[model samples]
Target: MIQEIKPAIWQILGKQPGRNVVIIGGTHGNERTGVEVVSKLKSMIESGRLNIIRGTLVLIHGNPRAIEINERGSEPHADLNRSYLVDLLEREPTGIYEDQRAREIAPLLIVSDVVVDLHATNKPSEPFIACADSSGHEQVYQWFPSKKVLSDPNYVLAGKLVTTDEFVDAHGGTGLCYETGQAGDVTRVDEVMRNVINLLIDQNLVEGEVRIPSNECEIYEMIEPIVLTAVGFTFAEGFGNGSWEPFVADQTIGYHGDVPLVATYDGVVVFPKIQELRKEGSPLAYLAKKVNERKKPPRD
Candidate 1:
């Protein structure tokens, strides 16, 4: 049976208890694919087309207020996707829409066995997966078709846990973020939906014949996120537009004012910030190098 847990959160319980799974959409309100995916799942379940067979399935509309206005976030200071930090979740309400929303959603994440936070980039790009290296994380990501995986073992993204998947991982759960290309594109909705359904089946949360897809992936260990400096930063030339761009050792990446930002090693730059999204102290872009193999975290 499916029941509304909150304004934009719903819980579907199976007769046989199992893993607690939370699938979040609209975390960044402008990411339409996730929002649409959750909406479609709700409709499918409500209309008797989909079934939850053995576990609790939670569907969350991550930032309803921002989603209502069709913006990345409702507040200027807080990003819902980055508001899940421990301090923020444990503190008294800050009156910021996204911060307060994170507080409301923390409990669900605390109890989740698996979390799939759907997202999309602001600029055009191919789909990719981001998560820490772990056995649990590996279990889910293999089901997706994305060939590139960013493994952040040292928390270079924000210097600490902030994203939904990161928070989930902190509490000993499998968490992953699926970037479904650009926010405005909906071409992959059906494909993404099918992938999630297949995941549910594999986990025994839904009944079906599970056909696990290829697990081969080009793993990249995240080196660091290049923070926009006070003097401001800019990609050297023809870079930082979007997607992945490769650079050789000692090559000039961009400029921090008049100072040249040079690459330390051969790697690919992913998730380059467009001009509008660039902010002092925020990530302008992130660097990663292809790894020979992934190192899984020790099981608890």
Candidate 2:
């Protein structure tokens, strides 16, 4: 049956007991694809057009306030996606809207068996999935069509970044983040939504035959983040064109002052911050190499 857990959160509890599934959208507020997908699912359930049969399905609107204003975040410098750390969730509420949302969402994630947080990029880029390398994560992500998987098992982003997926993973759940390409693009919505429904069916949370993708995923293990320095930084001419753009050894990713930031091995730059979003003390971009490309390639 359909039930509202909060203003923007809903629960569809199945009669049979099974895994606790949580799906989140609008984590960035401006990423409308996820919001659209989850909202449709909620409406279907509410209208008796869709039904859950095996587990509790939680539909969450990650940041309704930001969505109302159609902005990346509800407040300046307070990203809802980056507010899932344990300390922040445990402490007295800072009264930040995102923080309070994180705290309210924490309990659901802690007991969830699977969590999928949908998102979109600010710049033009290929769609991809981000999650720690694990069998649980593999089971969920394989259902999606995106082949580029960013696996950050080491907490490489200065070990300070705690996102929704990472938070769910900490408590032994399969958490997956699906970036559905550029923020304004709606072309992939139908495809993404189909895969999400397939996942629900495959997990037996909903009744249907499962559809599986045959494409093998290319895994990129995160090496480290390129931190923006106080002197400032700039992307190389061909780099920062998009996420997952490849770079070769010694190729300059950008420059900090007059010093060049060069790659040490063949890899891709992930999540390069656009000029307007660039902030010092935070990652300007992250360097990652394919799982098999960790060893330096043979050169003449």
RMSD to truth, every model: 2.0, 4.2
Candidate 1 global lDDT: 0.85
The candidate that wins on lDDT is 1
Candidate 2 colliding pairs: none
Query: What lDDT tens digits, residue by residue, belong to model 2 across residues 38-154?
Result: 988888888887889998999999999998888889976668988888566558887888988898888899999999999998877888999876656777887887778888878
Model 2 stretches with alpha carbons more than 4 Å out: 293-300
Q: Counting only residues 3 or more apart in sequence or on different chains, how many pairs clash (N, Cα, C under 3 Å) in candidate 2?
A: 0
Query: lDDT per model, in order?
Result: 0.85, 0.84
Candidate 1: residue 132 Cα off by (Å): 0.7
Instruction: Give per-candidate clash totals.
Output: 0, 0
Tens-digit lDDT track for model 1 on 192-266? 898889889888899989766656677788898889878988787767767678888899988889898877788
